[model samples]
Target: MSNSQQSLGDYGIDIESNPESQDRQDPHTIGILGSADDYAPHSIDREGLPNINGFDWEVQPVQYGPAEILEYWRLDGDFHDGLSHEKIPGSGGIIIRGADDYLREHALTEIEVPDYYTRFENEETHCRWSADGRTHISWRFLKRAVRLSNGYGRIDPVTTRVILCDTGHLFVSGPRGAFLVDIPPGRIFRNGDDLPEPPDSVYETIRGIQVPEENPELRTAFERYFRLLSESPYPSPISHAGFNGADHVLETTSEKTVVNDNNLKVLGGQTKPFEDTVGVYSRQCESTNFVVSVDPMHLPGEIGEEVTLSDDITSFGSSGDTTGIITGYRTNWREEDHIAPSSSGVSTLHFNLIVGLIMPDLTVTRRRINVATFEP
Candidate 1:
């Protein structure tokens, strides 16, 4: 996309649109963005999303190669602003690509928010707002192909109407605003008469939004592309969790809720591949782990109901020392409480582990909701 080709003259029904003349601007809109702020609370650029505590990584275009594409779920973030990318796997028999290595190389080796993408990076700054008189902001969760890989890819961005590049630049319209359009140097994102709503997924949970489909003439006819799938969903994250039912063995908090019991009904456990983000040097961590945020996975039992702990405590991650009980040996999606992609047909539980000299022993525990109502 080029800036020379498209101009401010052609914006769409959603997000920002330069109304030709300054007098035509809305009272709340600010045509120009990226200026010094004075009225906002923090000194930061008053971005729409939370503060980005990260370092920019100039993709080692020469030394580092694009991550070997695979068949696993992953989080692809922007090198500039933090944005979550979920996920895919690769070729060459190697399962875990640890795609985030690109970030670690740039010095992002911490895990603040337990997101499937950065389980260390920032939230997707992928949307912007253009309120009249209000300073406009444009943040993009770039779903890009940073590292050129050497293997076969499972998901490649399909050639659509728009000229999809290695990067998926999301054009935002701010809170509950419009998003998802390419923003290259010469490309002018034309808000289609019909934009499509984003399908619900872990990415949606991370971005904290349900992206709507465009009006029509959706994407521009792109000539070339690199990615398997390209998308930009408005984020709507649950920074907290609610607690209900038998409050006997559950710990509740604003961000998350934990329920534990001795008699958890056993479900299933299987081995799955993942790109670990915790290891320091090793490409493989034997006991590496991952944290997942699941939906209404486990069937909540009645208050004071009984459960039977399953034997298999299943867990999956990379090859390295684990510090937490990422998983023991148990079924992932079959149990409640654990994350299950939330997308249709995907029952795999996402993982995030802490690496150390010693493996963080985990127990992928599971239990039935109501033993009293046990059935065959």
Candidate 2:
């Protein structure tokens, strides 16, 4: 077989409209356009990839797919083979061309996360700090997989270096170079108490929207909410409603602390104890109440012991006022309170979030370096 043929068949992914595959997946196509003529023999060179954020990323080349497949991968290009191949982002691993390929896959391997990365605030987009003085970075890891469509439609593990940034940018190293994953833009609803009503229109409440007929009463409430949304001026009502719902939940629930993987912190107070925890400066505003549940095992003092922020801990650098006292430590650590490292073959050391004070000026934050297992 020629190099082109070898490359295409090597990974067991076929772009051509196979009769058998077509019959099976008639309703949903993998967004592949044109024929074999749209594909040209392209070899990827993986040498000299620059180090991003102080770590050398070992990026894998695009295991040759037709140019049209790039679009299915949400890459920024068209189906023309004549487009520049010199600048395709390294795929880090094999390409799973489409949603059909994703469905056919069997299992996914947990993504190994890079330790030395930070999710800081982009003032243009999000808040600068959390209720605590520390900066919170939103991030999560997912499983990577690929499927062989032409073969027995077998699923196999593949590496796709997916990095979630704080500024709502998702970078995936795929068929092309590192490209931004497209996410629908959302407007932030700061106040949960006030939900805006939808715009006025002459349609029954959620008239066309599909809801389960079994739960008429529940459906009625949903219709009421949908009516409110239908009358709203927001372009993306679903996304807007989601944000509003979260805010509403926070408002109604007694547990005002919104702790998730994104905002969870391991305030070890002293950073030297945990190799997986990195110290960061989080913001602590006067208006927000800074409270944390302490895991005493990670703390230097007893549960009731009051420690001065400046004199007791080295986690938050010496820049802020250290006179603040952290008292009434509550040992309320949950399962999701800890974080582990992401790189391969590291004896997994789980680090729990520790209790620390929201100092007047300096609120030190520590984040987990490990990537969480993929959910879907």
Q: Note the Cα lDDT for every prediction shown.
A: 0.20, 0.26
Worst 10 residues of 2 by lDDT: 142-151
lDDT of 1: 0.20
lDDT of 2 by residue, 269-337 (tens): 222332233232222233332233223234444322234443333432455434322321222212222
lDDT of 2: 0.26
* Clash totals for all candidate models: 99, 14
Quote the positional error of residue 314 for candidate 2 in Å.
3.9
lDDT of 2 at 137: 17
